[model samples]
Target: MNPIVLWFHKLGSPPYFDRFAARWAPWGHGLGLLLIAIGLYGALFRVPADYLQGDSFRILYIHVPSAWMSMAVFAAMAFYAAIALVWRIKLCEILAMACAPIGAAFTLITLATGSIWGKPTWGTWWDWDPRLTTELVLLFMYLGVMGLYHAIDDRRAAARAAGLLAIVGVVLLPVIRYSVVWWNSLHQGQTIRLFGESSMDASMMWPLAWTVLGTKFWFLGSLLVRARADNLRREAGKAWVAQAALPAVAADPRTEARP
Candidate 1:
């Protein structure tokens, strides 16, 4: 077997991952917090507001990133589901399951922030804009996966069902992306763009992009911590779990007696 596969195989085991997360969690949290602080400062004070939108456009700092994350999480969940379906890997299913609530949380944040922004800019708190409608649908799909997980009694069965749902739900992504073009809506066109000319200036775009990156890091850290806890809970009865859970070289003779 390839070394990379061999390393992954070892890392896939519950104990290794648990230990890895423990070591990495603090650094992840620290980095995320630092980046978020800097990003927020730049967004709030350094960046200038749009001429037309005025102060109301400030909500984009939060709304846009959360919206981006909502879609990103779903896409990630779908990819994980595909991995679980094709390879029948338990780890992939567990990861996909773990991501459901997080994705749903981001979706909710996106909706709330968009609503808040809309109230000031569009004169209402809610609109049936293509992106907003599809995002709500994405949130529902995430809820469906979580509901399915709890509905099934067996862990593996629940993961498989949820994985199937996630894979099937990938259709929502394209719909959300095309919603603005497909229908007339209050939501404006894209502000920050990669290929085309973005309406946003440098100060606004950079901070927003930084905020997005910080959130992505925060999500990774959150997932690692959650996944670690999940694995520890699932493996609680195993001998290795007991050994790994305890501190090293305790000098208690009984600790060695457990295999």
Candidate 2:
């Protein structure tokens, strides 16, 4: 318990977090690029085409992973928000805010790719099915949190409000998770599960797994980058921000003055 508390304590410090984020950013970005390259290779060429869906099902390589990230990131953001609310931790709130835009991007990719996949498979670009509908709501919730954060002038107050909204809106996660079971839909059942036998072939499963891993790392990289930027924005008047920015500002002006 003491270790856990100390861990959170360290992460909650702005200077500590800024340094930690910078240290990990290079590794995160490098690994994300490597994983995406590997995943794409497996997804595009190594894996065989689906017998039923053919080339169109290949879209799942991107769509399914992006859809998974959308939900996974929100649930993660909500957990961070809960921590902030319970512990009154500013770092948690900043982390949650950082996650919102990336999660929204994944949600958008999910919708766009799903639409592309649907056109050839379902004969339409969009549907009001439960999965699709819930996904739309999920995107709105992300936007709402981000918008609310900026709406208030006071940063602390904005964080608290956004945290509250995130915690409450997490109720939608389970609904989105079980939507297929709760309602009739064109979308299929879950393919990946802990207890259930795998629904997909090994060839397909391997690529899909790689895709999921790539997407996860991509989010991690984006989260760190955005968190650093958010911290810089919030701490613009602080000594560290001034020190960090001044060097770059001076270097740029010198370069411009030279030319």
Candidate 3:
């Protein structure tokens, strides 16, 4: 077999994947922290305030990235769901399940920070604006996925059901992003263009970029950590799990290393 193919084949094993995840966690944390520190410094001190919004615009540093992650993680979840459904990959199912809460957390942050930003900008905390309302709906979608996953008893059944929900909910992702374009709304349009000149100053743009990158790495670290724990629980009775648990079991001689 090709070396790359062999490596991927081996990674499909839960124990192997768990070990990889553990090894990557520290590196993820280190890089994530470094990028976030730099991003925060630039966002807070180096960048000049907006002429109109002034310092209140600084909140965009957090709100923008969180909103991006909320959508990005959902898209990833839908991809994982497709893999689980098409190939019946257990790891993919676990990954899809693990992504739900993290996505939801980011969604909550987006909403909270947006509302806070709104108070100073829009003269109120809430509104029926198209983007905000759609974003609010996106939060409920994340919750629905989580709720459906937990409501089912069998792991396979739960994953399939929740995965389908996530795949279907993929439509909402674009809606949340383009709501401002599709309807007249109070929320501002996209300022940072990946391929073109951004509306933001270079100093502000760089920090937002760094913050977005930091959040991406953080999300991966969090997902792997959660998946590792889930893998352990689901595969507790396997030989690898027993061997992995042996140290703790030996330390406590009274306890069985049983699943």
Candidate 4:
């Protein structure tokens, strides 16, 4: 087998995954927080205020990253769901389920921040703008996946069912991405681009880059933590879980073996 494939096969083990998550999750969290702090500082103190929107536009630091993650995470969830449904990979199932809550959170933040930014720019807190409405529906899709996953008692069955929903709902992603282009939207067109020219100035773009990278790292950390917990839950009573839990039990004086 290819080294990469072999590594992934080893990673499928619950104990190996738990160790992997424990070893790397903190790095993701720490780096993510640090980058976000630097990004916010640059946004607040380093980057100049927008000529048109003034300081209110600073909210883009939070709003844009959250909005991007909202879609990105859902895409990831759907990808994992597809893998699980096709291959019956337990790790993929856990990861697909884990992505839901985090994606929903980012979606909520995007909506809230968008509303806050809109009040000043659009003179309204909410609008049925194509971009905004489809994003809201995206949130509902995340919630639906989560709700469906927990509604059933059988874990593997629930994951398969929810994964199916995730796969189906993925059709909404392209619609959300192109909504502003397809319809009359109160929302502005894309200003920042990874390729070609961006309408945003370089100074402003740097901090936004930091924020975007931060969110990705943060999501990585969150995914690992959530998946590890779910992995433990699903593997409860297994020999590996017992072995993994032994150290903690031994460390607790009350649970220690006594003569």
Instruction: Provide TM-scores for the models.
Output: 0.92, 0.92, 0.94, 0.97
Model 1, which residues run further than 4 Å from truth?
A: 248-259
lDDT for every model?
0.84, 0.86, 0.91, 0.95
Write model 4 residue lDDT over 8-82, tens digit each, in one string. 999998899999998899999999999999999999999999999999999999999999999999989999999
For residue 241, give model 1's deviation from the true position in Å. 1.3
Name the runs in model 3 displaced over 4 angstroms: 248-259
lDDT of 4 at 185: 93
Off by over 4 Å in 4: 252-257
Which digits, one per residue and each the tens of the lDDT, describe model 2 over residues 175-218? 98899999999988898765778788876877777778878877
Best by TM-score: 4
Query: Candidate 1: TM-score?
Result: 0.92
Error of 3 at 249 (Å): 6.1
Per-candidate RMSD, Å: 3.7, 2.5, 2.9, 1.3
lDDT of 3 by residue, 111-169 (tens): 99999999999999999999889888889989999999999899889999999999999
* Candidate 3 positional error at 77, Å: 0.3
Best candidate per lDDT, number? 4
Q: Mark the 10 consecutive residues where model 2 has the least summed lDDT.
A: 250-259
* Model 2 stretches with alpha carbons more than 4 Å out: 1-7, 246-259
